[model samples]
Target chain A: MIKFLESIGTNILSWIKITQGFLSLVGQTFYWIFFGFRKKRPLKQEPILDQMVFMGARSIIIVFFVTFFTGIVLAMQSAQQLSKLGGTIYVASLVSISICRELGPVLTALVIAGRIGAAITAEIGSMQVNEQIEALDTMAINPVRFLVVPKVVALFFMLPCLTVIGDLSGMLGGYIIGVNNLGINSHLYIQTAFEYLTLKDIYTGLSKSLVFALIIAFVGCYQGLNTRGGAVGVGRATTISVVTSFILIIVADCFVTGIYYFTNL
Target chain B: MREHKVAISVQNLVKFFDGRKVLDGISLEVYQGETFVIMGGSGCGKSTLLRHMTGAMKPESGKIFFGDKDLTTLNSDETEAVKRRFGMCFQSAALLDYLNVEENVSLPLREHTTLDPKIIRILVKMKLNLVGLSGFENLMPSMLSGGMKKRVGLARAISMDPEAVFYDEPTAGLDPIVCAVVDKLILDLNKKLLLTSVVVTHNMESVFRIADRVAMLHKGRVLQIGTPEEIKNSQDPIVQQFINGRLEGPINFAENIDDVNFAGEG
Candidate 1:
C-alpha cells in the first residue's frame, strides 16, 4: 500500500513538473515575440518564409482531400434521414454550417498535427540530441528566436489559410452530393448553403485554427527541445508531440465551441 | 608557461545532477595561448567541467571567470556575447544536417556578420582548405565519413577565428591514423592562430601529443594539474593506473562488477 502511494505521488509530481515546463516554454515564446516587435526589428523573416512554404503550401493537397471526403460522408449520412422526411433541401444548411464552423478547423488541425508536428519534433529533437542546439547557443544564437519563433509564426498565419481552403473544398463536396445525388436543385442548394453560413461561423472556425496552430507548434517544440537519450528519444518525442497536439486540439475545440455557444446564447 | 596570464579561471565550482555531485568544488586556471587538456575516465565529469567553463551549463555554486569578467554573474545576452568569443567542436561533430559543408562552415559568419556573399564564400573555402576539405564544399554531412565530419566540424569551429576553441573528444571514434592527423592539425592550428584551447578527452595518446598542460579529473575532483612530464612522473596511484591502463589499482573495476551482480540478484 505504501509503495503504491509513493508511485502515485511520484507520477503526480512528474506531471506537475512537465506542466510547469510547458507553461514556461509558452511564456518564453510569447516573450520573444513581443520583445522582437518592441525592438523595432521583429524576428528574422527568412526562416519564417521557409517554414510557411513547408507547413502551408506543402500541406494543402492532403487537407483538401481529407476534408472533401469528410463533407461527402457527412452529407450522405444526413441526406438519408432528411430525405425520409422529404426535407432533402436542408442538407445544404447542415453540411455548410457543420463544415464551415467545426469540421473544417478540427480536421485541418489534425492533419497538420500528424504531418507538420511530427516533422518539427523529429527535426528539432535530432538537433537536440546531436548537440546542434547547444552549438547554436554557443554561437550566440537564441534557439527559440532562431528556431521556434519562425515555426510558430508560420503556423499561426498558415493554419487559417489552410482551414479556409478546407472549408471551400468541403462545401464544394457537399454541393456535388446535394445537387447530383440527393436530387436537390443546384440553385436552391447553393442559396441555402450561403444563407445559413454567416461570416461569424466562418470567423469562429478560422480563429479556432489560430489557437490550434499555437498548440501544435508549442507542443512539438517543447517535446523536441526536452528530448533525451538519442535516436530512440527523438522517435518518442515525435510520437508524444503528435499525441499531445491531438489531445490539446480536441480539448481546445470543445472550450472554444462551448464559449462561442454560450456567449451567443 | 607558468608565468603566463590566465585566459580562464574557474574557482570553487560545484555542480549536481539528480542529487549527486558531478563537479565538486574544483578550481583551475587555463593560461593564455596554450593547449590545456582535461583528461579523465568516462563519467569522471571532464566534459561537465568543460561545459561549465564554456557557459553551456551552470554550476550549482561557483564562479567561472574568463579573463576578468565573471561568467557566473552574466545575464543571458551577456553570456551569449561572451560565447561569441569561443567555438566548440562537439564529439559527434554536430554539423547541421540540412546544410551543405560550405553553408555549415559559414553559419557563424552568416549569423554574426554582414559580409558579402563572395567574401563569405572565400572565407568558407579558406577554412575548408585548412581542414583539407576544400573540394567537399557541396557535400552533405551524411555523405562524409567519421573523420571527414570531424574535420568539417573543426573547419566550422575555426571559420570565425574565435579567440578560444573547446574540443569535446575530437578523436573519440577515429582510427589511429586519423587520430594522429587530427592531433597534428590541432597542434598546427594552435601554433598558427595562437588560440587558447581546452580539450577534454580520455585518449591517453592525445593527451601526450597535444597538451601543453594536463589536468586529470577523478570522481568530480581535480586529481592533479601539471605539465605532461610532471603528470607522467607523478606518484599518484589513480593517475598512474589511468595513464597506464592498469586493471589493479585504488580505482576498482570490481566494484562495478559487484554492482551488476547485486542488481541481478535483486
Candidate 2:
C-alpha cells in the first residue's frame, strides 16, 4: 500500500512539473511576441513569409477535400432523418449552422494539429537533438523569435483563413447534396444557408481557430525544445505534440463554445 | 616561451545534475593565444566544463570569468555580447540541414552584421577555402561525409573571426588520416590567426599534437593540468591508465566488460 501510494505521488509530481513547464513556455512565447519588436534587431520578415506559405498555402487542398466530404456526409445523414419527418428543407439550416459554427473550425484544427504540429515538433526536435538550436544561440540569435514566432504568426493568420475556406467548401458540398440528391430547391437551400449563418457564427468559428492556432504552435514548439535522447526522442516528441495538440483543441473548443453560449444567453 | 595572459578563468565551479555532481569545485585558467585541451574519459565532465565555459550551461555554485567580465553574472544580452567573441564547434558538426554549405557558414555574418552581400560571399569563400572546401559551396549538409561536415563546421566556426574557438571532440568519429588532417588544421589556424582555443577530447594523439597545455578531468574534478610531456611523465595512476589504455589501474573497467565465453560452448 505504501509503495502504491508513493508511485501515485510520484506520478502526480511528474504531471505538475510538466504542466508548469508547459505554462512557462506559453508565457515566454507571449512575452516575446509583445516585446520582441522593441529589440535592437527586430524579428525578420522573410522567415515569417516563408512559414506562411509553407504552413498555410500548403495545407489548403487537404483541408478543402476533408471538409467538403464531411459536409456531404453530414448533409446525407440529416436529410434522411428530415425527409422521414416531411421536413427535407430543414437540412439547409442544420448543415449550414453546424458546419459554419462548429465542424469547420474544429475539424480544420484537428487536421492542422496532426499535419503541422507533428512537422514542427520533428523539425525543431531534430534541431534540438543535433544542437542547431544551440548553434543559433551561440551566434546570438533568439531561437524563439527566429523559429517559433514565424510559426505562430503564420498559423495565427492561416488557421482562420483555412477555416474560412473549409466553411465555404462544406456549404458548397451541402448545397450539392441538398439540391441534387435530396430534391430540395437549389434557390431555397442557398437562401436558407445564408440566412441562418449569422456573422456571429462565422466570427465564432474564426475566433476558435485562432485559439487553436496558438495551442498547436505552443505545444509543438514546447515539446520540440524540450526533446532529448536523440532521434528516438524526437520521434516521441512529435507523437506527443500531435496528441497533446489534439486534446487541447477539443478542450479549448468546449470552453470557448461554452463561453459563447453563456454570453449570448 | 610566450608570456601568459589569462583569456578565461574558472573559479570554484560546481554543477549538479539529478542530484549528482557533474562538475565539482573545478578551477582552471586558459591562457590567451594558446590551445588548451581538456582531456577525460567519457562522462568525466569534460564537455560539461566546456559548456559551462561557453555559457551554454550554468553552474550551481561557481564563477566563470571570460577576461575581466564574470560570465555567470551577466544578463542575457550581456552574455550574448560576450559570447559573440567566442566560437564553438559541436561534436556532430550540427549544421543546419535546410541550408547549403555557403549559407551555413554565412549565418553568423548575416545575423550579426549588415555586410554587403558581395562581401559576405567573399568571406564565406575565404573561410571555406581555409577549410579546403571552396568548391563545395552549394552542397547540402546531408551530402557531406563525416569529415567534410566537420570541416564545414570548422569553416562556420571561424567565419566570424572570433577571439577564441571551443571545439567539442572535433575528431570523435573520423578516420585516423582525417583526424590527423583536422589536428593539423587546428594547429595551423591557431598559429595563423593567433586565436585562443579550448578543446575537449580524449584522443591522446590529438592532445599531444595540438594542445599547448592539457587539463585532465577525472570524476568531475581536475586530476591534473600540465603540458603533454608533463602529463606523459606524471605519476598519477588514473592518468597513466587513461593515457596508456591500460586494463589494470585505479580506474575500473569491469562494469563495462562483457561476460561472454569466447571458447567452445561447452
Candidate 3:
C-alpha cells in the first residue's frame, strides 16, 4: 500500500517533469526527427472545425446581430438619460465608447466561451471518461500535444479576429439607432465616436479577448483531461468549464483593465 | 506455426493502483511469430501488464525485455525508439473522429516513414484492402459500423510493418461472425507478416481460435500458462468457471464490488 502511494507520487512528479520538457522544446523538433517520431500516437485534432463552426461561424449571426440590439438599447437609454441633463448629443460618445471599448470584446468572448468552451469540455470529458485518453496513450501519443495544442492554436487566433468583427457590428447598430432614428446628427455621432474610442480603449478590450481565449481553452481542456466517471462526469465538466470561464473572464477583465490603468502599462 | 525465438520478456514486474498492489511480482516470456494470449477478468491487471510492456505505464520494479533490449531500464527516448518496432490496437478502437479511414490507417506510416503522401496513399490503399476496408478511405469513424471500425483499427495497427503488435480485447463486444472475421485477420496477419503478437482477451472462443499459448491471470497473479486444450482440461476451478461462463465462483460479485465498502453508496 505504501509502495503504491509512493509510485503515484513518483508518477505525478515525473508527469511534471515531462510537461516541463515538452514546454521547453521549440516548435516541431523531436529527438526522433530522423528516425520518425513513431510514438506520435494519433494527433488528437479534438473537434476544432466542429467547435469553430458552432462557436465561431454559426454563432456569428447571433453574436453580432444580438449584440447589435444590445448596442441600440445602450444608445437609446444613454440618449434619454443624458437628455434630462441637457447633454443628449454626447450620448453618442458614451454609447460608442462603452460598446467599442468594453462591452464588445468581453461580451462576445463570454457568449462564445459559454457556447464553444462548454462543447470542448463536454466532448473531451466524454472522451476521457470513456477511456479514450488511455486508449490514445496506449498507442503512445502525447494527449496534450495531440488534444490540447490545436485548440490553443485555434481559439487563441480566432477570438481576436471575432472580437474585431463583433465591435464593428455593435458600433454600426448604435449608429443606426443614435443617428438614423434618434436624430443625433449622423456626422456628429461619427465624429464623437471616433474621438471617444482612443487606441488605449480599443487595445484594452481586445487584450481582454485574447486573455479570455486562453482561459476558455485552458479551463475547458483541463477539466476535460481530468474528467472521471462517465456521461455525468462529462456533463459536470461542461458546466464547470462554462461557469469557470465566465467567472474568470469577468474577474480577469477587471484585473487586466485595472492593471492597464494602475501601472499605465 | 513455426518454432519462434524470443520476442518479449518480463521479469519480476510489480505495479500498484490507488495504494493497492494490482500487479504483484510477475514474470513471462513471449516468443516471436506467435499469438501470445493473456486472459484475465476486469481488474486482474491484464491491461496494466500490457501498458508496462508497451511503455504506456512503467513498472514499479523489475525489467521488461524486447528481444533482450532491457526496455525497463531505458530512458524515455530509448523506450520510444524501441516502441516504434511495435503497434497497438486498443479496446475502444480509439479512432480519431476528425480523420477518415485512410488518414487513420496512414497515421503510423506518416509518423514513421518519410514516404510522400502519394506513396503513403498507395500503401494506405493496400492496407485498407488487406483489412477488408478498401472503399472506406474517406469515411469517418462516426460513419463506420462496429465491425468496420475494428477493421480500420487493424489497418492502422499494421501500417508501420511493426515487428510486433499488441491487441487489447480485439474481438470484444462483436457479434459471432465479426469475431470470426477478427480471428481470421489475426491468424492471417501472423502468417503473412510473421509478426509476434500479444493479445489480452477474455473471450474463450477468441482464445481457442487465435492463441498459440495462453496465460490465465487470477487475482493479480498468473495462475496457469498452457495451450487451449491444456487449459480446457485443467482442474483449476477458476479457469473452469471462466471458460464455462459459470456465475458462481471465487469471483464474488456484489460482496467485493468496490462500492460496497464505501460510505458514499448509501
Candidate 4:
C-alpha cells in the first residue's frame, strides 16, 4: 500500500512538472513572437510546412468525424434530461451554447491531443531512438526550430481552425438530432443557437483552443526531443505525452471556462 | 615533428551521473587536419566527452576551448555559431527519416546558406559522390541499409564544408567490411579535404587504419594518448590490458562484458 501510494504521489508530481513544461514552452513562444524573434532560432520553412500538413491539415478527417458524432450524442442525451423541466424545447440553447462555447473546443482538442500528441511523441521518439535529434545537434541545427516550433506553430493555428469546423459541425449535428429525433422545430433551433452564441463566447472558445493546441504540441515534442534510453524510453515518453496532454487539456478547459465566466460576467 | 596548430583543447573535464563518474579528468589537444580517434570500451564516456567538446551538453565541471574561445561559458547562439564550423556523423546515421537522401544531404547547406537550389543540388551531389553514393540521393533513410545510411550521414556531415567533423561510434553496428569502408572514407575525408576529424569508436581496426593519434579513455580520464604504434607498444598496464585484450590487468570491463569477448589483439 505504501509503495502504491508513493508511486501515485510520484506520478502526480511528474504530471505537474509536465504541465509546467508545456506552459514554459507557451511562455517562450509568446516571448519569441513578441520580443525575441531574432533570439528565437531560425526555422527551416520547408520541413515546418511538412509538419503542419501532418499535425494540422492531414488530421481534418478524424477531427470532423469525432466532432460531429459527439455533438449528436450530447443533443440526444441532454434533450432527454431537460424534458424533466418541460425544457425539451431548450435543446437548441443547450446544444448551440455548449457546442459553440465549450464542448466543441474541448472535444476537438481532446481528439487532437490523442492524435497529434501520440504522433509527435512517436515520431520524435523514433528519431530519438534512431539518433536523429542528436544528429541535428551535431549538424548545428536547432531541434526546437527544426522539430518543435513547426509543430507548435502548426498546432497554434490549426487547432483553432479545427475547433471552428468542429463547433459548426457539432451544432449542425445537434440541429439534425433536435429536428429529426427529438422533434424540435428546425427554424427555432437555429435561431436560438445563434441567439445564445455571442462573438465574445466564440472568440473565447477559439482562443482557449489555441492554448490547448500549444500545450499538446509542446508537451508531445518536448518529451520526444528529450527522450533517452532508446526504444523503451521512446515508448514511455509517447504514453506520458498523450496522458499528460489529455489531463492538462481537461484541466485547462475548466480553468479557461472559469476565467471566461468570471471575466465576461 | 611539425608544429600542428591546436584545433580543440579539452582540459580537466570531469562529469558524473547519479554519483558515478563517467568522464574523470580528460585532457587532450587535437591538431588541425588530423584524424584524432578517442578509442574506448562501451560506456567509457567517449560520446559524453565528444558531446561536451561539441557544447551540446554542459560539463558539471570542466573547460573546453575551441582555439582561445571558451565554449563552456557561451550561450546557445554562440554555441551554435561555433558548431557551424564543425560537422558531425551521429552513431545511428541520424538522417531525417522524413526526408529522402538528397534533402538530408542538403540540410546543412540549406540551413546555413542562401545559395541557389541548383548550386545546392550540385553540391549535395558532390558530397554524396565523395562518399561514393551517387544515385542513392532520392531514397529515404529507411530504404537504405545500415552501411548506406552511415554513408549518407557522412555525406551530410561534410555538406557545410566544415573545418572539423566529429564521428560518434561510426562503425559500431555495421559489418567488418562496411566498417573498413567507413574507416577509409574518414581517412580520405581528412586527406582529400584537409579537414580536422575527431572519431569516437571502440574499433581498434578502424583506429589502426585511420588515426594520426589514438586516445584511450578508461574510467573517464584518458588512460593513454599516442599513435597506434605507441598505444600498442606502451608499458602502461591499463593500456596494455585494453590493447592486449587481457582482463586480468588494471582495466576493468563494465559488468557483464565477459573477458572472452575482449580477448584478442590489443
- lDDT tens per residue, model 4, A1-265: 9999999999999889866876776676555445545754454466567777887788788878887898899899998899888887788878878887888898889999889999999899888777788788877776666677778877888899989999989988888999898887889888877887788878888988988998798889888876776689888998988998999898998898898878864
| Native contacts retained, all candidates in order | 0.90, 0.68, 0.32, 0.94
Per-model TM-score of chain A alone? 0.96, 0.96, 0.80, 0.85
TM-score of the second chain in candidate 4: 0.93
How displaced is residue A140 in candidate 1, in Å?
A: 1.3
Model 4, range B1-266, lDDT digits (tens) per residue? 35999999998998876566777888999999998999876666788899888887788887999877789998877887888888888888889988999999999888778899999999999999999999997899888999999999999999989889999889989999999999999998888899999999887788899989999987678988899999999989877777667768665545426422322100
DockQ per candidate, 2 decimals: 0.86, 0.74, 0.36, 0.76
Candidate 1, residues B212-250: lDDT per residue as tens digits?
999999878999999999999999999999999999998
Residue-level lDDT tens digits of model 1 in A1-265: 9999999999999999999999988887888888866633377888899999999999999999999999899899999999899988999999999998999999999999999999999999999999999888887777888789899999999999999999999988999999889888899999999998898999999989999999999999999999887899999999999999999999999999999999993
Fnat, model 1, is 0.90
Better of 1 and 2 by lDDT: 1
Worst 10 residues of 3 chain A by lDDT: A26-35
Q: Which tens-of-lDDT digit does each residue in A133-184 have in candidate 3?
A: 7656655555666666667657776787788888878888788888777787
Evaluated on chain A only, model 2 obtains a TM-score of 0.96
Ranking 1 against 3 by DockQ, winner = 1
Instruction: Name the regions of candidate 2 deviating beyond 4 angstroms.
Output: A1-5, B255-266
lDDT of each: 0.91, 0.90, 0.79, 0.84
* Best-fitting candidate, scored by DockQ: 1
Full ranking by DockQ: 1, 4, 2, 3
Q: On a 0 to 100 scale, what is the lDDT of residue B5 in model 4?
A: 94
Off by over 4 Å in 1: A1-5, A37-41, B255-266
